[model samples]
Target: MLATAVESTSAKIIAGSDDLLAEILVRSPVSSLIRFKCVSKRWCSLISGHHFSLLHTFRHRRSKPSGLLFRHKPSLHPDATTAPESDFELVQLNGGVSTAPSLRYFSFIPGQSSVSGTIILQSCNGLLLCCSFPFMAGTRRRYYVVNPTTQQYIELDPPLEDGTSAIFLGVNLAFDPSKSPHYKVVCVQITLRSLYNYRIWIYSSKTRSWRISLESFAAPFDMVFTEGVFWNGAIHWINPYGASLCLDVDRECFRKMPEIPFHQSNLAGKSCRFFGESNGHLHLVEVEGPQTTQFQVFEMKVDYSQWFAKYRVDIGGVVAAFPEMIHSYLDSGDGNYYDFSILGVHHEDDEDESLLVLNIPGKIITYNFKNGNSKELVDFAPAGKDKRLMPQLGCFDIYQYSETLAPV
Candidate 1:
């Protein structure tokens, strides 16, 4: 009887150990867990499941972001500074606050070139939706959904039929791996002739096809660089008139959200405003003062009807913190000099530590909101050959991206 009890206790201990191991594996980074999936069939099933993916995302979100992904596409213009053979390049900036961060070249799945696209439509769940080069005299555009980490990609066909005259305004990716492996590629395709020509097409991975709808208000007037932001089961883009264009991912329908309030003067510049998401809420970064030194960040209300002023940052503080660093804009001969504008904000895991990435006339500065300190992140002029690049100039597109093992 004692021998039998000993064997039962040992079996219980073994089962407990297995349970603990599974828990630990689920918390591991997607890149590491993906390789472990090959260990056994059971491990593969567990690691690939929606639940595991969700857990992994949540855990990683709590940690500092891994690095930034930079996409460079030189201009094809005759007068552009870049060469015609300037093949598209994707760069990875890998490191956290602890390690020395550096940029490295990344290779896509062989034979595939990402630079063919005009804009990186959207990035969701480690997958990127890029709008391909215009074809048929700008009448059609192809989109490629790619996983940079895995170097795998899938090209999505045009969502319209033959002779359906339409212009693709903007594209966004809706992918929540915790719900399913399948994802959705959404585009705002507008037929210019008609007042009601604004429509949205959603491409479903499960169906392997596209579906278009015109169920909501007219297409948003402004679907520029402030691409759609995915939040609360919907994708959102700022409308120039005030309201926002929202498309429900699950319901596959379009709706209007309240307009974002911006200072009247900010309406002057085409690239004056910026949109982003942080801690599950939609935020807008607006240029406040004439000098552009002051910025007001607003967080959308939970109901999506209003905005609350969240943080107001004075970039001039950076000048005081780093007195030795000379800003080019300070020497402008024009009496009216453009002030530094908020390009982006990188929030840290602790919530208290966040960096306000700003753009001056000729450089980039990262100011720590928590510590009230600042440092030069990059200079557009002489930092390096690849420095000072912007998508509009046909140079490069830079955004904050996390590293993951999300397969194409």
Candidate 2:
């Protein structure tokens, strides 16, 4: 009788207000909520509706944007000396047509920032955490967290006087929009090749002080710094050198995860390393490699110990379409492909289950997972085609529900 009444309360709350439902459910027991969703059809639908799904996406799918920093000549004067501007963007993977011709992109330029350049790392939740080295010599470098949509930014004081000489550094950003007001930031450092030289530091909102965590890594491994994706209870990073390891922000300790399967082909001679968050867990995808990516999708399963083949795609000549290109793989495990909100409905299909390979040359080409179809979008590319410029590889992903939300 009590279970039935509690279930009724959940249903009423969900039907009343999504924010109210989330606020109530977030603090409730996860097991009880899972059981409540299975109580009745109306309850199930309410929990699975767009609002509930979006709240779930924010809880589980919050992610950082991925982009590259490169030098480009804004003008076409053979000897033009235009200093390179950091071209940053976020790639949201869509489950609909994979090879959609036109792509969507969000550009990031440091506003009124003293110095900004291409981003090297990101934390989920659409924040590009970056290092902007001084535009001039002998100056300090500033680190920033910028929300591309809102254009709101937070800059950190420069680290040790000679940050250039520091051996290893990692930044962990916590995304708890509930109490954080602003997410918490942590900076980790280890001396160059010095054992037991590990240190953890955090910038708090309440006290506005750098607090060092009590926990530490006994023997830190070599790190390839990217955004530490916040998931489950800890944040994960790609430690490609050996097995994967993560930090428990609450506990502040590093723990190893099951190894991600690697193919000989991927390690042969790829130029860039690739890894992305789909749903939640971490997955390593092929960025650039000798392997002719005959298969486009693979999953890091269970606990990152094995790889599962999900789907396959080919852009054909699409690589030649744009002067700028990027590839970021996103995983679609939600099983909600029918909700075409943005409705990449640019064109209709002429053939049954027939996919369209990008007719032009460019870096990215997506695929329609269902019915094996593809389409091209014109909106998310460089403005006006310049025949001379070749779009080099950058980052790409499918649009998810969280990204479809009003940008901020």
Candidate 3:
């Protein structure tokens, strides 16, 4: 009985040591941490505290992406009668398995039911910026910032305007737990009077309110504000027509990014295949012709000075392995098409460990930049009966997935 009592006392001492307990808890997976909250009030407070969340984020900041959330394109059939079987599918990366939250997770938000039509706009860190459209006309759309891992969310109303007609451009989420536990949502709106003039609205979780920025700026012609990636303490909006635009979130000011180095002739028929921030790096990929099997991966310098080629990617081996990726067109004059999309560029501390995630036809594969080898990550078949009516899997929207215990 004395030995049993001694062992219990030792366990209590270890549990009472906040620093030691936190060191162990920070290394635990988010799913386990969530369940650990029920152990006791002390454990609950420690795990949910902002300081602990920040520490956990810093510890796992270099972790590879857990998975990807793929939002499938809507049906294109003229007489479609029902919604697709599944609107979203989570594809695991690096052979890791994780649970994907469904629309039911959003039920906690007030006045939001039947969230089938809701769509994910962006995934920053571990939070998701989602939009839910009204079922009836004239009802204002709603925006939400959700932490799926924690099953917590907050609804945001549309930013108010000054009585002038404006088109809502896009909203992006910026969350860096290492810097602050709070997150910010950025909204862009353009005045109908001028195509180049744009206004910025920012929502701070700390303030729990939205405020309009005093700095209104004009952008280059055809410069799109959508898909602005937050990296290096700024949100960058890539422009194919001219110089891309960068907004310093901290300073609330606009700046021009270095011009894309590609010559006009090189980019004439090409498109921005992938533009995203991963592991503190911003990568851009462009593909020219339909059958093009070669391209360069460009990485932005840390100082925002310019972009340089990071990787010379040749996907000829992928085509040779997966013949379904080669699309032959008999009726058109255009050459055979290469069916693939660059989903992301994952950089690791070890340069040789870097991988380029790609989607080809019905399979998701990761291509090693160093060895030029390809490995299939996930294989999925088309959902509907008529495959031709469904859009190519590569066309689906892909969002990075990372687990976090940060509160919404």
Provide the RMSD of all predictions against the true structure, rounded to 1 decimal. 6.0, 12.9, 3.9
lDDT of 2 by residue, 88-162 (tens): 233223322222111111224443331323333454454545555344655455566654433345666633435
Off by over 4 Å in 2: 1-83, 86-120, 158-168, 176-182, 192-197, 214-222, 240-242, 263-266, 269-272, 300-307, 312-364, 377-391, 395-408
TM-score per model over all chains = 0.71, 0.54, 0.86
TM-score of 1: 0.71
Best-first order by lDDT: 3, 1, 2
Q: 1-408, model 3: which lDDT tens digit per residue?
A: 999999999888888899889988999988789899999999999998878977887777655566787654532221123323345556676664333545442555666554335556788888889866555655566788987777678888775557633346768888876677788888888756686877888889999987887447787766656678998878888677446888888788876578876776666688636889888899988888676899999999998799999999998998898877776753276677777778888887787889999877776789999999988876654664432223455322677877897777
lDDT of 1 by residue, 1-408 (tens): 999999999877754674555677867776687689899887777666655655565556433334444333333432233222323322222222322122212234332243332445566656667654442343355567876654557877775468663445666788765565678877776565665556677788889988775534465355552367776778887655455667788877766676677645556653446677654556787564344456667778877777887777765677565433333556566443344555566655564666666654344566776666777654345444433233332112445555555545
Clashing pairs in 1: 242-259, 291-339, 380-388
Residue 243 of model 2, lDDT score: 46
Best by TM-score: 3
| Runs with alpha carbons beyond 4 Å of true place in candidate 3 | 1-7, 14-24, 38-46, 49-55, 58-63, 72-87, 96-116, 162-167, 330-335, 383-390, 393-396
Global lDDT of each model?
0.57, 0.43, 0.74
Order the numbered candidates by TM-score, best leading: 3, 1, 2
lDDT of prediction 3:
0.74
